[model samples]
Target: MTVEEVVSMVSLIEELEAREAAARVRVEELESQIAELMARLEAERETWSRLRVTRETVAEVVAEMSVPDTAGEPGPEEPAEPAPVRVVGAVMVPHWREGLLVDALPDVYRDIVEVVADASTPMQAKQIVPRIGLPAVTAKIEGTPGKLKRLVERGWLTEDQPGLFALAHRATVESGEGAER
Candidate 1:
């Protein structure tokens, strides 16, 4: 090749190398910005999660405090007779003589009860896991079937067939009526 042609090619190579280095620096800056934004997003998400938990805890405390003590009288700090609380979209239900059955239930049993209450037909324990959104891995655990049978024994559910279970049709167990439980 001629000297002039070789000189032109060397200049072109130098320009291309400079552009490549600049592109790498820009990419690093963008990556740092992305990492900072991701960290901020995670912090905001954790704050939101904590707020949700605090709200739920406050609601439970208020509900429990609204109920009168077992002595058939208001607490000394409370008014002699507090005004009746009428919850919006809530139906008046007769107080259960046996107390809240759901209060005595474990989380899994309550989920089972809710699933059966919503179902049009009775469900077997095997059928219940997926309907209640339990993980597939949990369905394979031993004693899962026994848990459903125990619900029947506790009078929360009834066995319609050999293996199928349904919610007990009691006043305190019906939908809307016992929803507070």
Candidate 2:
């Protein structure tokens, strides 16, 4: 090759190498960012897991409290009335009873109860999602079934069929008849 041609090729190779180095730097930066994001995601997942366990544990404790103690009556020293439902960090689902009103539930659970009570026929989780002012997106829709199942477990709602949900036995608060209960 001619000397001039060789010089030009050398300059082009230098530019290409510079570009490749910049690309490698950019890749490293992205990898670092990805690693940070992955760590944050894992921490978030752990928090979510802990919160779920807390919720389930609270539900179990509430259920146990609701069951009438068959062993014996409270001694004269102990109060005769059952302990009132307690609200901890997040309001827990209480076992429904004659005097337990829908208003006592957490906002979302209350909304779900009201929606099911309002529906003429039993409704599915997807159908209930939008009625409570939530977007009917797949994530919300998919998440709702778990709430519905929890409500069923807590006696706030019933699953007449596989997916269809209805109020367990209570009327809506708006009705005023069973509002206090």
Candidate 3:
């Protein structure tokens, strides 16, 4: 055809190419954003899955610890051992009595209770959990200082030192729950 018509067609083609380049760049940007969002979703999903598993395991451990071998019940694939006896308020009480005293407790507290009772000496909260078989954490209970501190609140136990606890005389009373006033 004529050069002028050919030039006009070429200009239109160039403009179309520019638009296609802009569309390609936009597509690339959207793809990058989608990739980042997907990565974040995966990380969040992994965190939630880990937390769910942790909650289930902790619930099982606490339930198993709640009853222990206080009765004739076999526990946790481990043979039940007779609770150690200690003189509290001039009466003998199971050293693991604290384990039986509370209905619910944090895992570290449950671990600390059994651990402290079996320990050679009454230990502070900081010392008891680590020395006995618990994850040592300086982090205090929500409103309390440590395991012994919470046990003292339960009234079945008493704190002898800052973070140490001893079973109360009430631990041996007829109620057997240390609810003694």
Candidate 4:
């Protein structure tokens, strides 16, 4: 059209182009920041996971050691206090009687209970399968979910959420307070 109109349009175009380039640079910076934060988050998660596993393993070892070798006869008498119960992961397990408690469970229920008890958070049945070192095929079996549900019903475990499980109170299970169900 006119020279003046063409010049004005060119100026507008250059301004818009500069803004678009600045926006693109900003978007790239934000993307890079997000990627860095995600990497940090993953590293922190791995560290926390390792710490939780170590804590659980130490608790288990301590529990094993606390059980006395009661098989020997005729020792000098000092009135012994009951063993203390301690938190293992998120569950209360007796420092001396974990083995006895596990032994009291039915064969099918023991592994599942142990996995839930040792977890630092509540677990779903699907999650429990791998943690218990069961075959992936076992998760597909209907009985797996049913067994977990039965444990909840029996108060050996608690359903923390609709499908997530955790250990029930140690005293309730150990004292036979919840055994009637």
Stretches off by above 4 angstroms in model 3 are 67-181
CA deviation > 4 Å runs, candidate 1: 68-181
- Predicted structure 2: lDDT: 0.79
The prediction achieving the highest lDDT against the true structure is 2
Of models 1 and 4, which has the larger TM-score? 4
| Cα lDDT tens digits for candidate 2, 1-181 | 9999999999999999999999999999999999999999889867876787678667667667665673587888777666655545545676676666777777898889888888899999889999999999975886688788888988888897999998877553554344443
Backbone clash pairs for candidate 2 read 100-181, 101-181
lDDT of 4 by residue, 1-181 (tens): 9999999999999999999999999999999999999999889867876776576557556755765655556356822443454544533343223324554564557777867767889888778777667776642433367667756765678786888888875653445433432
Tens digit of per-residue lDDT, candidate 1, span 25-63: 999999999999999988986787677556644644554
**Which of the two candidates, 1 or 3, achieves a greater TM-score against the reference?**
1
| Model 2 misplaced regions, further than 4 Å | 1-74, 85-90, 171-181
- Give all TM-scores, in the order shown: 0.42, 0.57, 0.36, 0.46
* lDDT for each residue of candidate 3 in 1-181, tens digit (9 for 90 to 100): 9999999999999999999999999999999999999999889867876775566446445544554455657768756665433322221212334445532333455455545555566666665645655456533321124335545654546677766665553333323333422
Instruction: Sort the predicted structures by TM-score, highest score first.
Output: 2, 4, 1, 3
lDDT per model, in order? 0.65, 0.79, 0.54, 0.66
Top TM-score prediction, candidate number:
2
